[model samples]
Target: MNLLPAYVLLDLETTGATPARDRITEIALIRYENGEEVARWQTLVNPHMPIPPFIQTLTGIGDDMVQAAPDFESVAPRLYQYLDGAVLVAHNVRFDHGFLKHEFQRIGIILRQKVLCSVKLSRLLYPQHRSHGLDAVIQRHQIVVAARHRAMGDVEAVAAFIEAAGRELGEDRVALEVARLMTAPSLPPGLDPSLLDELPETAGVYLFFGADDAPLYIGKGVNLRSRVLAHFSGKTTDMAQAVRRVEWLETVGEFSALLLESHLIKTRQPLHNSLQRRQRQLCAWRLAAAPDIHPQAQLVREDAIDPTALGDLFGLYRSRKHAEEALRGIARNHALNPRLLGLESGDVRASSEPDAQHYLRLKLALAAQRLKDWPYPGKIAVREYDATSQRTQLHVFEHWCYLASVDNEADLHDVLAQRSTPVFDLDIYKLLQQVLLPPAKTGAKPAIGGLEIVHFQDGYDQQKTSSSSQ
Candidate 1:
């Protein structure tokens, strides 16, 4: 009764965090059979790319060190042999597993192995401990290590922790924990496990497709792989079973993910995403600007609404009926006459109050739902960057409407050149309000901070915009 029949304690150092885009720079693993050490292997992989300066400082694996080493394709076969039929053991196993899977796929070899994460094991055995990262584990167990961030050093450290756990918790207790972790949740028969392996654990939106390429669901997540896998964990739903293909678009941050998810759900109209489906009859209350008007509220359809007059717009409703019902409720709550508000057909004099007082009450009741005007004088871009992947997305906006999201500054001119009349979207409006508007209370910070707002006044000037952004 060993922890596992056979397992390979492994670790990897990569050029970056994203597996699909980044390459592996180094790998190390020690294989065990029947609780006895069997084989040990390590290699420096030439990623064929420049390693970031920070990564070089962190892992001490610079371009010069790996320039002379064998590339991943050259080492794939032997690495596969070492990992064959072995439970992959590593600290934060998904990171290592994702990189390995992507690298192997590049060489036309599929690498699949049962993974056991040492971090999870640490948590299970030591529930009282709040930290389970490698640094934390090393400090707790007093494990000796020749190196810290290097691949072989980390692999050795993790193996030492596992051995120490077995001794302290007893072999049987450790074995039980290992067994519990080894039993991975099964995936649907229609879906390929490799697809899940290829998913990057980053902010992104994912789409599930059923037969004939019909979209079953569209969703966004801060960690795409973990969120997608959670769907198939305990019990597979009918929608999950119908999912035959999976696709994803990675974003720099959750903000972009939310925007993209909202856009896709409305446009694609996925069968299971009924809540976010497009509202064909979307309407909002447009308060009358004229002073002498009796019933001051009017319902305007989405196509007829003016983006420039957002300040006058009140609550967004799915249909004309919903807008009427909401306004009726507002009138009732404010003690205003529904007949004067145009909810009912009657003589204006029949109302108990004067026209001015009734209009004031109507405006006061709808003040909370009033849409905020665009704060900027012109079009602005909210830039989001992922430091790990070096990915950047610039979301351009004007009058609370999303113009376009571009990856580079070079495309900004084209977006401006092709810019058409900004059609206001209720979802995009709400999102921008949440992210960009100032806090309601005086002297309070906004909901989201550290946003890089670049202004495009007269036109898109690359140099000026670049300097201004900096």
Candidate 2:
């Protein structure tokens, strides 16, 4: 039996991994019909951009080689003819398909075809093998190639692997696997499949909208495409089916995605986002100042939160009742007086300790929840950069509040000039703590991994001073 009636074994060598930002430098494919090779095509297309040195080193196709070659637009029609009405076969087929769809889109041609992944085929055929990468398959099956990393070379390797699979694991079984792998992922009837192709595999926030442009859900992911596609995989859900439109905003990194996700969820109040909705009555415990004779703790509401006194704040609770419940739990566990904590009306004799000792014990119990003081003397901008897209985002923060994310110096200046008192957010505070706080054992300074920290002096006139990573 023929493994596939018609299929094209394809591969692409691109400038980088991201299809939305990077350009394809080369394309190669071999069309097969009835288990026989009918046509072979390969070309070096000018990407209209400089191929990075590392990519050139890997693919052995440099600027000079593609200088005279036709650009993707020039080769679009012929390439489409070769690809149309055939199952696109490749190792890690999504990577190749994503690039093809994007390139075709640039020329106003929507390229959509059934796909079969040889890597998945290898995994399904040889379940014991841990690695199904092309290199691993080539070495395991002893398939020789005229070249490697180059587009044509990788295509040949994948084609050889499929042919060998037909021989080793009966043609019937190979064909069965091909049929199973060709089954496309289901998409909502109202949603467009092309939208999934447009999603970049980068850090970003995505919003799903239902009928009448009502928001169904809002979420963030490092790979927006993979995460969004996962919703349609396996068992379908009501939210996935209700989704009629999809929108996304790409970010420089995961931190920015997170901040945006939190902000959007609270503001938009999507139908499916139950947990991240705005906590209007959010409250926290503010410890009393030293030598004060007032209550040891006071419940402060969200609007009343003082950014300057964030260091004196404790656990962020959902409401007044939650705050009281938490303090009661701390008082019971630490054997402190409830009257001293302002939790009850009458004095209860939990312990005969002095007021200062009781306060000390309460403070000790709440130490883990106590907010950290802002390490910087002034506002600081956490700079996140993406090398692939050449994008930069400066996330400005005061205390634990996220002020704004700016891309240009002029915008940054504007943000500084229009500085207002930053409001403390529970979600932003938690995110910043997780990213900026150092480990307890190390006793090191707070630092964001792989990000630059810049300090602003006093006003818009103050120049940005870069500090060592902290």
Candidate 3:
């Protein structure tokens, strides 16, 4: 007889795949120690979200069945306690683990444990077998699974498979294979052991810190945990060694993650985030007062931009020097006068008269890149919704400048009542490319993370006039 290490056979029934957009309907786990069953637990989790019709039919966990069940918050504490210091075993552990982590992430809890996927275990132990899913395992071993898709039934099936494997091919061989599958990630000694469990696989911004809590690096990823883990997998640089701790903030999608990362890097000026030096003063050149004889380019500071009300704007640059360099390059390429572009303050004399003709064409070519003024006459809102988390955020914008993000219509009123000038961000301008631009400009259909455009045009003229006069 071989003594098996403490482990929990686990299974979950979720509303759907893609953990970011789905909810766990149920959880079942059977704990075993020294090759004997020690404890067993199961629960119907109130996802606080709707269970799709297909999921209900497939899993037989209808909305009505889970209506009065305790939400994950109510059960998280006990569930966390139950899995402590035990390896998590499941048919396809990633699927189960993903749902568990995502659910815990919503309520700001970290669920981390060594995971052993029995599906993988089956393949490893029985190399001759091509099919390793629970159904295949059950069919091959002739084990009874009373309930097919239900969590407890599936968990029991997994436990049975392990037992059969131990008897058929020596417990020692099974235990060694289980140990290999249960390997945990090796993390930095300075970081907490539990931190890896909390780092969500969802889109988010991650920050790394060094000694004295200095911002070492700021990064964004769709799968935050994998990206953060890859950085520490090998001792490649000082970055791996200098890091003390890691922190992350979750976003609904990649668009939000990238925007948040850029904003933090610019604002925090992390020592390791080495791209932009003059990111703090984002600026651009705008073709002011369309078609005047003196078609001069005006410097539009981000602090004063109303993107929705803007005219032809060009090349969002972080510094005055880069903006000037770009304008000069454009002038040189198009044979336009640099003086008219505000790169120089010299007069347009008789000899330089020919360059003015070139300036007119330059304005037209540059118009294509111009920021679209708020097409609607007034303020409008762009919405971003997370299908899985069921979280919605409405970003209010005026003249292309983002004003505020509100959760509900009632909150929209509060955001509008406060008179605030919309500031432009180069980072946001680029981030908006993911959603705001149509196929022609971005060269693809923009997926705005469920962005719904809403117009708030009533009494718009008055506000525009008031802000402009000021």
Candidate 4:
């Protein structure tokens, strides 16, 4: 066997520096086998979390742009396999490599592989030069810089430097150096010695497949290659029993990765993802009467909660039973009569009844905590992100009830144009009530402003049936 290992050039664009908290935005990888081109992959993944303004400006990747990209969990397997038997190449190798290892470790994967830092190679080969950064290398070697800090451009720069090194140093010398660079890093015995230094640090998801190709866990990171390796830093005692194969996905942005993850957990229902896939039931406390009218408590589903008009609504609940319990607690706290509050069905006491004073006292006391009236004139939606799946999900609300979620602009338009009345969901009601409610001291404001109300056809109802797979 030649034992001349294949090489992979990798690069990543992330939401921030910290792998544990921040997310990957973009990635690029180029595979070389025995000094010949083998394959290339790249993508933009939505981080599902907001990218700080400074990062947005630096990477030129932002929320509005990656709103539709697939999430990290969806793409982990393929990328992992690509790096399984290669030597990883990068400019500032440690930063890129360190980030990858951290992300993979979070999802419970251990990676071990030989890694080559071009910055180190540049320094080793050209001791006369002072700087070994990507910019310095590109400038010194006259390599064209396209896309700059973006994943693909950075990866291309590494490839360019490799070619330059090969040409200047002679094939024999370059081959020997690359061989020396291919020495595997120290890692846990069970982990593939071929893995750590090989993964591409790009926007996507990664999967840790245990013995017999069973998927042990899934994860997402901007730099897939580095994140994979960090798993073997000798800290993961939990993954000892089951890790074997490595897999990954190169995505376009973090939003796509998040949405994909949520969908995959539901679709694959992977053994390790069971806890994450369980959907929490959502409920809201709705006043039996409409806003602008006297408030009375009623339990409604979250999908029934209206976004634009949440007045007369209070408390989000995990279940209708929970909502009722909360209402009862509030009533007891304020001395409100359970009967007068409609906790039970019965006739109101006559004004002249001897016990009427007690009811009046109770009602007056409860009135202080009674739900408020809707502040807006119409309906709207609150937006949330699924970072792992990389999608922007719109939770619609109308008159203190959550109607449904829209995945795309077309779906948004369809939901807005639909004329059919949305079904009431108690869970959605609670969700809206809690989200829209102002703080005790500061009060709540519109999550987003000036939502247009128009006649709708409910196209989203049908679109939701299939677009969810994407």
Candidate 5:
């Protein structure tokens, strides 16, 4: 009921919109007790996903920036302590609170705390104004934010907004409004409610668990903080429920996070994640044999294809339904034969009508948009570094699929030489296809065959001369 009793001002940077699909990148919380700044905390979390180019540009938190930050598990306790027994306050409190609640829920903890949204308060008090967002509030109050979009600056802005509104609108009005917004939502009994400061802004995946360490959900994002918060803050009902514990995995790049998130969701099969796509259902439209020998219908996957080669292939789909739907649409629009195209269950017929020719033209146009050839040949690798662990890893792939991920060059070579052909994953294949297209240009560089495949056992790989056998 007492709105100002030990308030923790919080801000979070996250990956994307869907909490179950994104992760936290950074956290900043400033705790105030009796109207004084008592403590400050911050962290960069590996969200385990590629920061969308736009988000990275806006937040200035890129894949390279959080390369060394710790994962959420390592930083959670300190954050919990800071936010313990405090009212939560933020510009858009929904975003901050939702992320915290969801993240904590994943780690087997439930969090319920009084939340005060400055946006609501600002709107209520300034009824004439149309905007109540952070930027709007900062402009209205003439508050100078040392940094914009970053977690700490935003949290500080909220604190400033609260202080300014209290002065201009009177303490009673501000207090009452804060009290109204401070209603702590119901949470599962097992979680902890607290403010977190300075979580890293990195790409990675996060997980939530319920009672007895049961996984509830798994997600990936560019910014772990923002994505995790969206879950609890008036977004999706399913994300808010079924989470009791918070857990996360930090990844070096978006590719790693994407792969990891898919694998974890399948293996853990968290309750909250049940509605998510199943691995078996994941599919892609590989350009196989068209029913017509000359004029082919766009081939859809009759069965699953190896995902690693997905980059080599094209038209990746998460399920048969998706692939078929797309193909059917193409068939109808192009006037291609349904039976021939495999959209319908019947004999193949090559349409000879002028309408059919137009349809084929249209179908080719559509396929061109969706088709993506494999980017890399044989094996290629991307490197990831852990700031906290002070380690770097090389994620290796071949035929548009991952064979193995290794820490050292020796391991990379061993994986390359000894690793068996990876089973096909529609998701991974799609991912590789997306990443590998438009092969890297080698202007004056040596030809592919002349390029040496270096395998350094104790350290990094060495680009040695190619053997005469090649």
Candidate 6:
């Protein structure tokens, strides 16, 4: 590609795919500027750890090869010089770049650079081409490779492909593609592109901020970078226009992301997020009237929704109107007295007929069997593991109540010691029902997965200790 801007065609052989845990075994790059290759560099790095046998077989670089080679710390300065101002290029560049970043960061070095993926470039440039790996590119361009899995060999193949593209498609076309690949499209006015580069391609929560860094919307995804960019990469809407800045927090896995997203959305009540607001005022309909009295349905707020005290609750609704409307629909279908359910304004005395009693029985029978109660005896902690981070968090729940979450035992004790009122959230109930309950038996809700459910009775140890002391 004819360019004043330099590009470092890079490749790395690593111990494993993960950047955080794996070590780089080899490094190589071909530096180019103004359509000419100025220099090429390759080095075997001593990982200070044993390389797996499978890795050795794949790259043909054994322990003996790297025994005398310099480690990454020794080669950092020179490698940084080659990468400092250039657009980093590699097949699946994120993998190589993520590995190098972790390596550099360990020694107190921050490596941030614009990255272009040759694999993506190939896919974009040659839409008809299926595979864009080094071997595929080598075969496609009729370029012979001296080494197959070696770092320099892969770099050479990538360089040759660029050269071929420039020759066949013209220098201007090649440069245009390079420039396009390097930059993100139609980012919000003042929001920097470098911010996008800062995001990791891992599970995380992302927040969009408007004028004063006020959270506009918060969302979670398995891949943060792609999902975040997908927002601005499309046609600029009100969300795109309003987003002046962005922030993100990376999690170990999807489960952690899910928990954090739910928690934040419930607490923060971000302006743009309408679905899962604080739900502090969540309410449900509970049949409260006796047979002699008119059949009455009352709204039970979260704080007062103690299932032990208040039995036989009906539809969970977000607002009073919604609850009334639901009751109205149920009454109409059963031809129960609308005045009794507080749906239509009328005299309750107008419904003393035996038909009214029959309709009330019909309504209760229709809504009776499915008023679900807490299946668990007491407080339960569902342990969730983040495999990438190897972190475990205990999600403490009681009677379908999310009391608190703790990452360690001490914090878990503290969470258990503190007594918070069981706020019966409609969303939480539905979510837990869908996940924790059985679908075949309930037939009313979906069963998501089999979770590790543990039951802990509150203050049991204290009560036993007091009895023994007496």
Output the number of the lDDT-best candidate: 1
TM of each candidate vs. truth:
0.89, 0.82, 0.68, 0.40, 0.50, 0.72
Q: What is residue 218's positional error in candidate 2, in angstroms?
A: 0.7
The residue pairs in collision within model 2 are: none
lDDT of 4: 0.62
Candidate 3 residue spans exceeding 4 A from truth? 1-6, 12-27, 30-85, 91-112, 117-149, 156-185, 274-281, 287-306, 339-347, 350-356, 416-418, 437-445, 448-451, 456-470
Shift in Å, residue 82, candidate 3: 7.7
Give the candidate order by descending lDDT.
1, 2, 6, 3, 5, 4
Candidate with the greatest TM-score versus the true structure: 1
lDDT string, candidate 4, 1-470, tens digits? 11255877889888876565677778789887866777999988777899889878887888887788876665556667778888777777665666667666656776565677787677777789999888899999999978888899989887888778778876677667666666444565667655554565555677777677766677667566656666764565466346767777755444334434554555555557655554456666654443222234556566666544544455656666776777788778876656655676665453243354554554454455455554333455555443443445565556655455666556776566656665444333434454554223232333322122222233433211111122
Query: Which regions of candidate 1 are displaced past 4 Å?
Result: 127-130, 193-196, 416-418, 439-470
What lDDT does each candidate get? Answer: 0.83, 0.82, 0.73, 0.62, 0.65, 0.74
Could you tell me which 10 consecutive residues in candidate 5 have the lowest summed lDDT?
A: 446-455
- Give candidate 2's TM-score: 0.82
Residue 67 of model 2, lDDT score: 95
Prediction 3 global C-alpha lDDT: 0.73
Tell me the tens digit of each residue's lDDT in model 3 across 130-183: 899788999999999889899999998987888899889988898888776556
Please state the error at residue 86 of candidate 4 in Å.
12
Native-referenced Cα lDDT, model 2 = 0.82
Badly placed stretches (over 4 Å) of model 2 are 15-22, 119-141, 164-177, 193-202, 290-292, 347-353, 376-394, 406-420, 439-470
lDDT of 1 by residue, 1-470 (tens): 26788999999999998888899999999999998889999999999999999899999999999999999999988999988888988998888998898898887877767788889899999999999999999999999999999999999999889889988989898899998987666788888877654677778999999978999999999889788888888988999988889999988878899899999998899999997888879988876776357567878899988888888889889988988988888877888787777888888787667778777777889999897777666787877777656777888888888989999888888887775899888888878776664323323333444345567756565312321111
What would the per-residue lDDT of candidate 5 be over residues 168-225, giving only the tens digit for each residue? Answer: 9887888887766555444545555542322234568988776678777789986675
For candidate 6, list the clashing residue pairs, or say none.
none
Root-mean-square deviation (CA) per prediction: 3.5, 4.5, 8.0, 14.2, 12.4, 7.8
